[model samples]
Target: MTNGIRVSVVAPVYNAGPFLHAFVNSFLIQTLPGDSIELIAVNDGSTDDSAAILDDFAREHQNVHVIHQENSGWPGKPRNVGLAAARGDYVFFADPDDEFGGPEALERLADFADEHASDVVVPKMVPRGDRLYAQWRYETTQIDADLVTCFTTLTPQKLFRREFLLDQDIRFPEEKVRLEDGQFLSLAYLKASRVSILNGYDFYVIIHHPQQDHLSAKPVDPANYIGSVAVMAENVEKYCTDPDTGDRIINEIYFRKVLANFTNSRVATHSLERRQAWQRQQKWFIDRFITTSRFEKMDEIAQVRTDLARDGDLDAIVAYARAGSVDFTFVSARSKRGNIELAGKLSGGFSDGELPKLVVIDRNDKSRIVTIPIQLAKSQVTVQIPKETLPLMEGARRYDLWLSPGRGHQNRRIEGPDRPFSLHFTDDRDVELYSTKKGNLSIAVSRGMSTQARTKRKLKRIIGR
Candidate 1:
C-alpha cells in the first residue's frame, strides 16, 4: 500500500503569483531523487496567476501535484487538505513565499530521519535576510532532543512522520485562527517519541517577500491572538501530565508570546479600549497558567508589566508603554592597572530613587552573568572589571553589556561608537571592544600577544627597533 515517495512537501498557496516561480523551482531543483519526492501545491483561491502557475508546474513535472480549493482566509484548512492528500512517508509543511535552503536539503533530512528512526525531524532554518531565529537549540545535531528546551520553536515547518501524525489524529485547527501552528506542533511534540534535530546544514531558507505581507506580518487583534494562545495552553495542560514540565512549557509560552506583546513598543500604539481588552485577556492566561513563583523568575521588566496589567492599572501600564524603556550609551574604555574600566551613560524614565545595574552577559554561555551596581551622577556611570574576573582561561570570550533599570523598567543594550576600539591589559590578555551589527556594545577577551603588541613586534623585526 506504500508508494516510493519519501517526502511530500505540502505548500498552501494564496496570492503568491509573484513568488510562485522561485518557490516551485526550489523544489524542482532538489537533489533528492525525482521519484522519492513530491510537491503538493494547494491553491487557496489565489486571485492572481498563482493557480495558472501551479497548473503549469503540475503539467510539466510528474512529481508536482496541484489541488484547488476556495479561499480559506488562513492556511489551516488548506494545510489540512494538503496533509490528507500527501502520499509520502514523511510530510513537510512549507510556505509558498519561502524555499529550500539548497539542492540537498530534502535528501539530507529524509536520510537523517531514516537513520535515526525519528518521529519528528527539524532541520536548520535560516532566514534569508535580517530575520532571526533562536540559534542555540540548533547548535549541534541532537537525537531525542528534550521537548521542554525546544518548545520555543513551535512552527509547523518541520518533518513529521505521516504515520505518527495520523495515529495521533493530529490536524490543524480548521479555522481562520492565529497561532494554529503552535497548537498543532505542541500536540505533535507531546506525542512524538523520538525527535531529531539536524544542524549540519541549512535545510529551509525563510525569505521575506518585498511586495507581499506574510500572514504573521498582518495586524493581529490582541484578544483573538491571546485566545488562540489560551488554546495552546489548554493543549499543554491536557497532554503534558507532569506538573513541573507543564509549568515550564506554559511559562515559556507566556514569556515569549503573552508578556512580550505588552513589553514591546507595539503596545504603546494601541488605543485605550484595545489596551484594556489586551490586559483582560492576558490576565486570564496569567491567572490560569503563570504561577507567582514562575512569574517572579522572569525578567524584572516583565514582572513589572505583568503585575501592572493584572492589576488593571491602565494609567501605570500606559506610562510604562510610553516612557519606561531603557537605553545605554558607551563613552570610553581605559586600562586601569591589570583591570579594564568602562565609562557609559544610562538613560531611561526611572523614578527618583531607582538605579540601573550594569549587566554583563557571556555570549557563549548565558548562565554566566555578572551584575554590577552603578552610581549615576549626572547620567554618567563607570564600572571596573578586574583581570581575575575575565574568563581568560576559557580561550576567547565575548560579553555583551546591558543596562538593567531596576524593578518597573526594561533593560537596553549599551551602544558603542562607530568604530571598534581596543585596550590592552597588563595580564597579557588583549581586549577588543566593538559595536555589534545591532549596535550593542561587546568586548572580546583573548590571551597571549595583543594586536598592538603584535604589530609592534612585526615592526621591530622589519626596522630593527
Candidate 2:
C-alpha cells in the first residue's frame, strides 16, 4: 500500500529513557510534512520508561508507530523488524541516542534522492562528542559518488530506497554480530545503481552521551570482532566484480580494523597473552586481504606495525608501540613574497637512523601530495614553501601538516598554537594556520578580503556614501 509517507525512520530503541524525549521531538518537529514522514520506534525489550514514552508518542502522533520485540542484545534484529514494517518510499536508520541534524534534514534528503533517482543518499553527519567522522567526504555534494572511495563511511545512517533494498534482498545480519553495518552497507553500495552524497547541510548528528556507553564502546573480544570483519570482507569479495575494487575494500578494512589496533594505547596495557591472541587473529585477515602492492601504499608506521603483527612478534610489537610515540609543537610561522615558512619542534624517541621529513597532505584530495624543502636539525625542523609551490596549491583549501620519521618510520601530526596565525601575501591572498580539534596543525589558504578592503567597506556602510 502506497501511503502518503515519503520517508520511514527506523530506530531500534533499548533503554534510551534519558535521550528518548529529545530524539522523538527531533522527528516530531521536522520540516517535512507530518503526513510525509513516519517514525518507526522498535522497542527491543527496553526495561525502562522507553516503551511508555514510545506508546505516548504513538497515541499523540499519527505518524509515530511502535513495535515491541524481545531483547536481541544487538540492534540487528530490531532494525530488521523495523525494516520489515516500514511503509514509505525511502527508509532511514537512526540510533535512539542520536537525532536528526536539523528539522529540514529529512525533507532535503528525500528531495535530493527523488531529483537524482538515487538508490542511496548519504547525508552530512556531524559528531557531537569526541567521535570523529570523515568530514572530507562530505565537503561537497556529489551527484554520483564512487563507492570505492566512500567505503570508509559504513554506518546505516543513510537514506535508502526501500524498494531497492527489498529487490536486492539486503537486510541487516540478524545475529548478534559486530560490523553488521559494514556487511549490510557493502552489499548496498555494490548493488546501488545511483548513489548521491548531500554535503551542503548537516543531516545527521551523532551524539555521545557522557553517562551512557554506546554499543560500539563496549569491550569486544578480539577473536569475535575479527570474525565479524572477516564476514564483511568475504561479502565484498563475493559481490564485488572488479578485482581492483575488491582489493581496495579489503585493504581499507585491514588498515582500519587490523593494523590500527596495534597503535591503540590499550594494546600496550593488555597482558602479553591477550596481545598475542589479538595479533594472531589479525594475521588471518592480513594474509587473506592485505596484498603487498596495496600494503606498500600505507603510511610508514602502518607498514611496520602490520609486518610485525604478521610475523607474530608480540615482544617487538609491544616495544615498537611504546617507543613510537612522537610529539610535535608548532613554534613559529611567517609569510614573505608569497612564500610560507613553518618551524616546529619534534620531541620523541626516534630510532638510530631516523630522519624527519615534512609531509603536506591536501585535505580535499587525499591522494595529492605537495612536497617542499625541509631542514631538520637536532630538535627543530624548518619547512620553506616556495612561491612557485603556492600556485600549485592555489585555492580555498586546507592542508594537513605532518612530521614523518624519515623513510621507514611513523608520521606524527604537528600540533600547537590554540589561536590561529594569519598572514597576507603580496597578491592579497590570506593564509591562516590553526589547530584542529584533535590538535593537529593545518593551513588554510584563501583569497579573502584584505584589512584595507574591510575598512573601506565598513566606512562606506557608516557614511552611507
Flag regions of model 1 displaced more than 4 Å: 291-305, 319-324, 335-348, 361-369, 373-398, 408-412, 424-431, 436-439, 445-465
Which portions of model 2 show Cα errors greater than 4 Å?
Answer: 291-302, 330-401, 406-410, 418-465
373, model 2: CA deviation in Å?
11
For 355-452, candidate 1 gives per-residue lDDT tens digits of 56778888888998888776666657778876665757658888888877666665677787788778776567878889899888888988877667
Candidate 2 lDDT score relative to the true structure: 0.82
TM-score per candidate:
0.86, 0.80
lDDT of 1 at 276: 82
Model 2 clashing residue pairs (backbone)? none
In model 2, state the lDDT of residue 371: 60
Writing each residue's lDDT as its tens digit, candidate 2 over 1-465 gives: 259889999999999999998999999989988998999999999998999999999999999999998899888888889999999999999999998989999999999999999999989999997667778888878899866666788899999999999999999998877888988888888889988889888899998788875778877778888887787788888887877777777777767776656653766668877887788888887887677876866777667777888899887777666555555578899986578888877665454355456778878888967766466777677788765544434568888987765544567787757899998876667788898998888888888776788789999999995
Write down the TM-score for model 2.
Answer: 0.80
Query: What lDDT score is found at residue 147 in candidate 2?
Result: 67
Cα RMSD of predicted structure 2: 6.4
